[model samples]
Structure formats: C-alpha cells, structure tokens
Target: MGPRFQNNDRARLYREIYEQHGPIAPVVLPGDVPCWLVLGYRELHQITSDPVLFSRDSQLWNRWPEIPADWPLLPMVGKQPSILYTVGERHQRRAALISDALAAVDPFELRSHSERFADRLIDELCGRGSGDLISEYAKVLPALVLAQLYGFSDEAGARLVPSINALVDGGPDALAGRDTVKSAMSTLLASRRAAPAAGVASRLLYHDYARDFSFEEILEDMMVNIVAGHQPTADWIGNSLRLMLTDDRFAASLSGGRHSVAEAMNEVLWEDTPTQNIAGRWTTRDTQLAGRHIAAGDLLMLSFAAANGDPQVRPDRGSFTGGNSAFLSFGHGEHRCPYPAQDIAEGIARTGIEVLLDRLPDVDLAVSPQALVWRPSPFLRGLASLPVRFTPTPKSTAGGSR
Candidate 1:
C-alpha cells in the first residue's frame, strides 16, 4: 500500500515518494485503489491550472469499469453533483450562487460569532484542567460556526460533526455516516423550503439554480457545503493546536514572538496542509506530466502537503502577505473552493484559534506529541485526539464570560 493511507508520519512518506518517483508518482491506497500523487510544486500548478486535460467530474472516468463497486473512495472521488464536482459553465453557475449566499452573511457578525463560540468552549473546559483538545475543543468549534452560517442554532452544530467525520473517513462505518448526514440534511432542506429562515440555507433556496432543485439535489448540495465548510477549518484549528503544543520553534511564534494568528494559520497551511490529498482530476486522454506517463481515465490527486514541502517552496514563509502563491491548500483554477467569504472556513478558523490560545495560555499537550494517533484516511490529515492540560481557572471574564 502507498504511504498515503498510513496513519503515521505522512509528510515524510510523501517526501520519500518524491525522491524515489519524481514529481508525479503512482500510488495505491487501501482497497487497492490506484491513483497518481502530484508531489512537486510545478507539476501541481500545471495540472490544476489546466482543466481540459484533467476533468474534475469523475463521471468522465473511463476506468470505473475496473474499479470495485464497493469502492471505499466514493465519498472523496465519486460524483456528488455539486459545484465541487463540476467544471466550466455548470460549475460557474452553482459556484456563484453559493458565493452570493455566503456574501450575504455580515463579516462582523461572523467574526463575533466565531469568537463567542471559541470562548464558550474554553469556559466548559477551563475548569477541568485537562481534556482531549481535539474532540473537546478544536474539532467542535468550526461546526458551531457552520451551524450559524447554515441558519441552524449553535446547539445544532455539534450534532453534524459526526456525520461530516464519517463522510471523510475511509472506514467501513463511513457509509452509515453518509446516510445519517443525508437524512438530517433532507429534513433541514424540507424545513427551509417550508419555513424559509435567515441563513445560508435559506438564501440558497431562493437562488434561481436551487429554486428548482429536487429533494435529493438539495440534500446533496447541502451536504457538500457543510463538509467543504467545516472539515478544513476543523483540521486547521486541530493542526495548529498540535503544532503549538509540540514544536518549540513554531510555538514560540504564537506566544508573542514573531507570527500573528493569520501568520500562524498561513504557516500551518503551507507546512502541514489540513486537506492533504484531494482526487478530483481524471485524465481525459494519454498525456505525460512532468516526465511521467498519465493514461486516460486514471484518477489523479494533488498532494497539497507534499507540494508545500517541495524543494521550490520556501519553508520559511509564514504569511500570505504580498503576492506569494506558495501554497495549494485551498487548491487552484476555476474549481477553487467557492465559499471564500469571511463567515466560511478561513474566518472561523482564525477567529476560533486566536481566542482559544488567548484564553488558555498555559495549555500544553498531556501526552507525548509523538504518542498522538491519527485517523487512517488517505485523502485527509488530522489527529485522532490531542490530550492537553492546563491549570484550572475560574470561568473567564476576559472572553466576555461566554
């Protein structure tokens, strides 16, 4: 099996593959799923920037006949019929609608809500003196922010995290998770259609594209947005917290030395990309990329993690200041994530992490950082848990006592 599916030391494995196999290396994931990992900075730029040769729609795959019906990678690579999976004019239309709905959210309110959610989480955990920072804190914060964006109450946000985790996890239980998410989303879609509340979902309903959507379409779109919105932000917060607790040089920057929260977030984005590998491209015909032969219909994923660590990428760059495009964490080309608004992933991630660190200044990993476990998913990267400890403090008044 390729190093992609291995739960431990994934960044080192990708670098090893790059040294052995050059820019574009072929690797087999679990279930014997075969695909190419684009491992170089230059190679990824070319593939992502050029869409005609690499179709985002897996429906264009000529190799599906060879793939197993129970293919475990469906949740990642299979066609989900959303803006995320489409290309050209079809992608533009739906992407615009999602962007418009996202823009409707007030940025000040979004920032305020994220800070409030982060502060509230600290309030619950600060008295404990110890907790699994992953499940108890970082992982749950973004879902709460997303809950507000979707027009659902903040309490309802916690309920959707499990389903999102299931959808991304390449385990046997994932299908059941997908089903639960579908059922819940369908109910949400129905409620929005009937009552029309004031949130992203309600805004989406009135859009020309969604106005004619069937129940299944509405469910699929909603599911895609929730996963797209929450997963990376959670991963960002989780990865950042792990680095702050484990790496001294990195942690120093966060503790009032060099980097701001935005700088630290960009550093993590460039160094240890949250969404490690994403497979959307299907080779339309035989083509050679960066000296490697890519056959028609072969699946291809951009190794965002590997590309960031590529020799050409400046390992020291900490901020997205100026015009630097050194990271491909959010991807490139027309298919770049549509919801770039403040109330979306990045805003929630920055606001939440900054508040948590300020309120819990003494937080440190309870377990050896090396002892932490990772979920065994080939397409994504995150810790299984981050056990941490700090001196218990009374409820924080500085965080507005939220």
Candidate 2:
C-alpha cells in the first residue's frame, strides 16, 4: 500500500504493521484504494476457509465506483471469467478439470523437461564465470518448462519468458505484456482446438466439463493458469537460490549436498515467501474477523508473509523451520492452489535448484549479501538479480546428462 510494502526490509515492516494494527489492519493500495491487510495466520485461514463469507468474486468489492479505469491494481483485482474469480459449483468443476489435466503430466517427463531447461539455462552462464542467476536462470526456467507442458513450441515458450516477467512485475509494460500473453495463449488454444494435442491446453479444451463452459471461459482459465503458474515459481527459484548462497546453513548444498536444497526451499516459504500478499477475498456480507468490524464488500488482502511470521503461531521467529510444512505460503481453503498444481510448481522449483547445484558445484555469491536487491512489488517478493561466480565450464551438448 505504502512504500514500506515494497521496501527490502518489508519483513520488519510486517512486524511493525502487526504490532500497530493487530490482525486485520486497514491499508491503502496504489491509487489510494483502501483495503484491510489480513496479517494474522488464523485470521487468514478463517477468511480463506469460509469462502461463503469471504468470496472470490471481485464484483462484490465496495470501492469499484471509486476505482478509476486506469487503476494500476485493476489487472490484479479486476473481475474476469477466469477460474481465479469463479466460485461454488462451477469453480469446483473447473478446478477438477485443471487438476486432472496437470495430474496426467508424467512426473518423470516433468522432471526430464525441467532438467533439460535448467541445464540449458545454466549453460548460458557456465562459460562466463559470473552471471545473474535471476535473469539467466531463475526468472526464465519455470516459464520454459510450463510452456512446454502447456503445449507451446520451444521457440514460442522462449519468447514468452520476457512477457510473463513484465506482466507480473506490474511495470509500465505490464498491460502490453498482458496483451502479448493473451495473444499467444489464444493462438495456442485455437491451434489445439483445430488439432488436439498431448498437453494441458488440449486436455482442458477436450475435458469432460469443457461443454459446461464457453471457449472464452476456457481461454481465460488457460491465461490465468500460465500467468499464475509462472511468476511465483520463478520467484521461488530465485528466492531459494539467494537463501542457499547467503545463509551458512545451506553452504553445504553448493558442494553437491542434495538434502539442504529441500530444507532451504522450505525455509524460504516460511521466511521469504515468493507471494508476500495477494489481492484477496472480498466479504460477501457484514462480518467480524479477528475482532475487526467488516462491512459487506470490503476487500481483505491476504498477507501470506505476515501470516507465516505471526508470532502467535511461530513463537520463535528466528528459528529454522526444518521439515515443518505448516506454513501458509500457499493459501488454504477449497479455492487454494490445487494439489496437482502445487506438485507441478514444486517439481519445477526443486528441480531447477537441484540441477543448478549439481552443475555448478563451486558457485558462490559474486556480490556481498547486502548488495543483492529485491524486486519492488507490494504483492510479490523476489530478487531483482542474483549475481554469482563459479569456475568456467563447457556448455552441455544436446541430450547431455543432467
């Protein structure tokens, strides 16, 4: 809402916000749009759990009249036919269709694709001795893998990386980036419809419930699926890599120790989650949450980072989470990220990190830990660049071992 939300020290900012305003604090977003920031772990869980009271439909927002057509946050909170805003019975069917399609992805094939992309990305920097992990590897890897799974040609997928990055960054180019992504997905859907193929796009188009929704609805769902799938997974890779390089606890991972990769990733979800806040649940009716009075149609932003850090739940905030998986980095409830989608994201992120460590056994941060910068986004948290230096090595040839 304020500069503090985009600041690098936002972890401290969340603590301050919690200390000042309790669980649900009223805050203003860009363009002076006011909403409540839900900071408590239990409060967020309760709001997500009761989708009936806290709905996903953006039309229920009370401040739509005041929100200008040119509002920067419009792209995020704007109502659409996409599954993101869908609710109840139809939403259930759509979720099932998407889940089944994604679940059909062979885990071995998924890993194989991920490893291939990861190796290719690393190869781009392997000879340079120093490169930015964010731009060269983390920022582009997930989209490439996801694009393949979604039926895009390698060339088209390669072109999609920048557009996806721009769209999520919410920069001046965001609208243009959105347009590009829409066009690309539209083309892919049309192609798949004319001649069905073995990919998620084709699966969604020919699914059992495909008849229940229009072509436009399925198109929007595909757009949401790709955009939603890409950015956070990219951030997850960048954030996890940053943690492994900066924290001594994960130092062993750089030397081919595989166990620490999972630990570092789990720790990032608890401490430095990719999705810090989400443009979230709107109250369907007047209700009380964490003792805060709420009117019908009030917006409640879900602060995943804050909830994960909530003192009530995580009493020892400074302690490592180890193998604990209770963190709310992923939203909870019926509408939370589908289990299959979560698996896909996890496979992409984990494989990317694992492949990098295996390839660059001597990699270390090129810049001082303090010199690293985080991207300026109120809703997402990720490194702007992750420069690292390692011994120069030869690039992998096609079909090389991963």
lDDT of 2 by residue, 304-366 (tens): 999999988987888989999998888899888888888999999999999888888899999
Off by over 4 Å in 1: 1-8, 170-173, 211-215, 250-259, 314-325, 339-343, 397-402
Q: Of the candidates shown, which would achieve the greatest TM-score relative to the real structure?
A: 2
Q: Which segments of candidate 2 are over 4 A away from where they belong?
A: 1-4, 397-401
Report the number of the highest-lDDT candidate: 2
lDDT per prediction? 0.75, 0.89
Backbone clash count for every predicted candidate, in the order shown: 0, 0
RMSD of each: 3.1, 1.4
For all predicted structures, in order, the TM-scores are: 0.89, 0.97
